[model samples]
Target: MTMSLPQQAPSPQHCLIGPLPQLFHGELAAYGAALAVADTSAPVGTALEAFLDGPQLAAALALFALRFPGAHPKALASTWSKLYFNALLVPVLAASSACGWCFPLAPGRVRFLADTDGAPLRFVLEDAGAAHPALDSAARLQPLVRNHLTLVVDALATQYRLAPRLLWNNAAVIAEETLLQCQLLMGAQPRIAADLHFLCATAQWPDQLANPLHQPTRLVANVRQRQLCCLRYRLRLDFCADCPLDCRQRQAAQRKLA
Candidate 1:
């Protein structure tokens, strides 16, 4: 008589009953991304536009200045922008690429919460119920890039007297890093590659307008080099390892190795 093999169990599937999937819990918490809760001890957050327009921006910068004494105001704002992008983009990009879900991440719908130390505590979305499937990069991130982030970038660039390209470069780094982490965790999700290309490789957005995030970095001898300097060196007194301004030595070293 022939022996029969046992049947294998079905692979687990993700269902979006709430703001995030179980797979994303650790990643979201690491980035301080959270859904709004009724009993949160976190302070009430300001709408993104109001935060940019009101005294909230000044207060935030003041807190950042206190935290990093002697740093120039522009450098303070640039560093704060990096923190803000990290809190906002990591979860949004992870959810979008891994699960095909898009949060209504317009500035008005999002809020920034702060800890007692006045650092970013959480990025809260008011309505995760409005999420929908987005199969392409534009469908996933247009409102986020065009409506929310672009407005904030322009405001910060004007206020700080910094280059808008540098601010966009900061955002591009955050987006690229977030997608890289997601791919590492979930394997090669095609959407991640497509989104990365749309954000970094293409010079135009899906609408054919200029893509502010396009070609934010270049790869030389397998070493990634940023196209624009973020000026964090002003704060930290050292250039980032992959910084374009500081990459010549790294490139030379890599060339020797090859």
Candidate 2:
């Protein structure tokens, strides 16, 4: 079962991708407060941080469980990154583009709220999804998603201020990895991957992008204890099917058998 938008009815304000800090500030704030663990703390940072932890990552996984209902918990846990790509990242990109806004998401500017079960319910944007197109609305949408990815990563690294090379390496790696999920959710469009490569190229990412459709090279292996991603690690869940650990194991096992 694919994770298509729900068909109950589309309320402009009641969208999976709703205008935040405006349309549903109450709901956003309530959920954000849980992350901040206090109202006065920074909600945005706390919310993004949730994507990394097990309890918080559940918010991402729940989206898949809802769509592909009846899947075992372990099964859901295996592809947690897909949940982040489809539910958290893509919706923000799509919703913002539909309204013709940048909605430049930094951790502090957005809040992802979840149900009591940790399923992502909606995104609360820092600005209205109002459109003021600088270019043709149709042509500009893809760039919005690409640009948002670049901007948010910088912001996350800055917020953490951890000089470890791992953060940068992982972000570059995951950018390509997550784009695949985005393409799957978009029904396997080739352009999504193309635009993603364009963005990585335009940003001059340290990892030289060889092919937009292939794995991007990380300039340095800062992956100390790297699992290619930490999404499932929090749950002690199985490695993602394409995770580096699993990849190496498969290669080694193949060579040994030969």
Candidate 3:
């Protein structure tokens, strides 16, 4: 069974806490048109445009962000971009490609990866059982997962000028714990968020660095094409597509079963 999300919508006071939705809608529409041109047999563009204009994309992104705090903002944006483009955009562009494009017809599982530097990335696919062994140890992995997510959320709050009141209570302590956990899991001494920021800015592919506290980051994953495309971000980690960490446990279970 699929996991159920909390039914409560964002309070009116919290509505403006993250990135705006218009940015994603416009990008997805453009991407859909591009896909349509490639597939001569379908009117995928029109369908994709309509889907993007609907509420599904917004809802999906919001839910994913709320669910997975560990996902890098860039990764979340890329994941969402791919989902919107392929599942909703491409299909509407070329229905025949639906089978090929929709590797994850339903919400897939998510996994979080953090290097010694504290840069976090999320991996998502239909099954987690097929994932690397390091991803499967629930007892050992759960704390790290939680810590990564808390840090992302904290970083996002700092970047966006979002008030602490908008986040869950006790966010700072939670974030600190997360940082510690990431340090433990990676077997590296933890650096202060400020120090990590310096490292991220100098990195060759800074976008791959998960530092929502500094500026927005972008990442791309081509599940079928094996390409990595960058997605745009407004608020540091505001987009939902990049929040693969939210789906990690579920993906792990699914992959284990498979």
lDDT of 2 by residue, 1-258 (tens): 113222233343433333322322332332211211112344433455355433555444565466456554543443332333344534343333333344435554556665444444455555434455454423444443434333434433344342223333344444544454556555554455454555444443324432221233443356423334433432433454334555676456446434
Q: Residue 254's C-alpha lDDT in candidate 2? A: 47
Candidate 3 residue 38 C-alpha distance from true site, Å: 27
- Ranking according to TM-score, highest score first: 1, 2, 3
- Least accurate 10 contiguous residues by lDDT in model 1: 1-10
- Which regions of candidate 3 fall more than 4 Å away from where they truly are? 1-60, 96-225, 229-258
lDDT of 1 by residue, 170-246 (tens): 88887887777777887887988888888877887768799888876789779887887776656644566667864
- How do all the candidates rank in terms of lDDT, highest first? 1, 2, 3
Per-residue lDDT of 7-117 in model 3, one digit per residue for the tens? 233233222111122211333332222111112342112232232344533444556565456545544544433332222222121211111112122221222222122
TM-score of each: 0.80, 0.41, 0.20
lDDT of 1 at 5: 14
In candidate 1, which residue ranges exceed 4 Å CA deviation? Answer: 1-21, 26-28, 32-43, 247-258
Q: Residue pairs in steric clash, candidate 2?
A: 20-125
Which candidate number would show the highest TM-score if scored against the true structure?
Answer: 1
